[model samples]
Target: MDAWATFWGWLFVLVLIVFAILSVAITIGGFFDVK
Candidate 1:
């Protein structure tokens, strides 16, 4: 297997997970801020 490809795949997955968490967090924060 190619090391670069494997590395990039993991990086992409990690970034996606992080982005999802951040988006959910922001949505909750916004709801509280408006209350």
Candidate 2:
């Protein structure tokens, strides 16, 4: 049970990190977009 919980915790952290990175990339891309 403990191992299962830890696995989920790590997964959640990984997802959060990926989301943060993607958001930053999008924001920077928008800044540089020619419009």
In model 1, which runs have C-alpha deviations exceeding 4 angstroms? none
RMSD, every candidate, angstroms? 1.6, 1.4
RMSD in Å for candidate 2, one decimal? 1.4
Output the worst ten-in-a-row residue range by lDDT, candidate 1.
1-10
Q: Which candidate should be chosen as best, given TM-score against the real structure?
A: 1
- Tell me the tens digit of each residue's lDDT in model 1 across 1-35: 69999999999999999999999999999899999
Question: Per-residue lDDT for 1-35 in model 2, tens only?
Answer: 99999999999999999999999998999888944
Backbone clashes (count) for model 2:
0
**Displacement of the residue 24 alpha carbon in candidate 1, Å:** 0.2
